[model samples]
Target: MNDLGKLEDLPADYRAELTSHNLVPLWPSLRGVLPPGKPRPNTRATFWAYNTIKPLLLKAGELTPIEKAERRVLVLANPGHGLEKMQASAAMYLGMQLLLPGEWAPSHRHTPNAVRMIVEGEGAYTTVDGEKCPMSRGDLILTPTGLWHEHGHDGDQPVVWLDVLDLPLVYYMEASYHINGERQTVQPGRGDRQYARGGMLPTPVFERSAKTYPMLRYPWAEARAALLTMGEDMPQQEAVQLTYVNPETGEDAENILGFYALMLRPGQSLRLPARSPACVFHVIEGGADITVEDQAFSLTEADTCCAPGYTAVTLKNRHADKPTFVFMADESPLHRKLGVYENRG
Candidate 1:
């Protein structure tokens, strides 16, 4: 019997699935979410690593009653006390957010660079700053470091999306900052040109007036279409060689300790052989399994998981229905200083 509620009750075989995937936490695994010796069993690991060694389940059975009832965004930060110590570094924090159908997460924004990957949704749209990003499944909509953003159901049924933020990275560093958006809700396309990452004429870099990241959004659909039209395919043992560029300087997203996206397709998996930098992964669409140093776990839309630091991971999708994709992120502190990062998986 599989019981997601009790982490320890998980079937030994299923839980054993993670055996080979080495998950090395960036910080020594914390004793508990609250202060140590709080009698909470100290299972949680620095807001990022799963409390127990088992992979986290996102289904109704897995969530606490409050999380299921309130439709909140569950976060598992990277295993760091955290940095984003300043608003500038906030853009690098990543969070995994899930909203059941008809769930409306009241509007809010902070000084962190943010993005949403449509994991499971027939129809949804995120109005960022003021521009609306049509939420097709697997689409990536960026909410620049700061700017008001909210989710609404203007289409049919429920939707699931992954939210990534570098908050812990900032919080641990004592650089956390928050600011309420000026407007209650802003339209995206109907003449709201200033707030969008795409479909806008404003500069992408952070401005003196804004509290967070410089750019406002990066639409995944547009990026996906471009990749598909490129007439390219993944190389053996490798998905594809693609990197998010800093539009202003032709640099990679890591240059600024920034966040970015990576795509995967059916029967595609890159063998991540070793841990270099820590990253959080959000499944935008389809299905795939991750292998971290001998441990492996499969995931689908609305499902989020983290890859611990110093351990490499391989992402593979065996789905036959449509192309499976992922929106992945990392903290910029160490990567930016190194100027480069790579994965053999």
Candidate 2:
């Protein structure tokens, strides 16, 4: 490879003429856009401690009412992308949302796909397209793109949940917008109950479900139990993991991002291969030490972290007597859709 010529090396009049016509040369910046070996990602390894976020979130609740703020949230912005951008990774947006008791977040639908990982509190529920999904610690509630969703709480304390969304990508593509709507009429059946067990689905004998999203909420109890059962059944497996997928098609739960639950055995350390998609990890139960290349984050329950693409990550269960459960979200589906997914193990 040879050193590329700098833009300043070109004649001043030629540069002026090019600027006048809104034209620019690519040779000087070619290697930058087409970097060798791997991508020079701007997404860095970042961590957000739940303990630190909770206090600020409570203060936010006290400072602003639900009617005034609509959705009171504190974004877990990565410093690499600039805090103002409100992005956890290149394509993912993360925020800690606080909903106080007796409050309701009005109904609205947006273009970006989103999921809520409940961190704490009870008696809070999210109604997505009319299905009322109760909020429990570690539950995952989906508010997929263009689906009207709202939050309501009947509990005494403040309810906080980690909000993960594909907003950065959608906003970058200029398709990010929301439409307000009236309160939805609560539907009759819950999807989780209909598609409860593995290898079985509600027989759509009468007619196929017209709903684009059959299941909006994935209870943590089911996922945790599945991980425990798998751990016992397949003790030799390195990673006891389960993907959150659409039961009907056996595909990822949402289109742009992939969601999963991972379990680490007592005193176990698992190394994930370097893959070409940024990943976000949240501790659902127990503590774990996450190492992303040279950066290390000690994550307790409810804590979250992000790792950039093409970086090998290692996770270790800090507890020696119990298993550690983690919830992960990644850009794999989007990468595969763009035909750039890879695992460089």
Q: Estimate each model's TM-score.
A: 0.59, 0.99
Q: Which residue window of length 10 is worst by lDDT in model 1?
A: 38-47
Number of clashing residue pairs in every model? 48, 0
Residue 295 of model 2 has an lDDT of 88
Query: For model 1, what is the alpha-carbon lDDT of residue 53?
Result: 19
TM-score of 2: 0.99
* Poorest 10 consecutive residues by lDDT, candidate 2: 1-10
Best by TM-score: 2
Looking at candidate 2, what is the lDDT of residue 252?
95
**Which regions of candidate 2 are displaced past 4 Å?**
none
Cα lDDT tens digits for candidate 2, 170-257:
9999999999999889989999889889999998899989887898889999999999999999999998999999989899999999
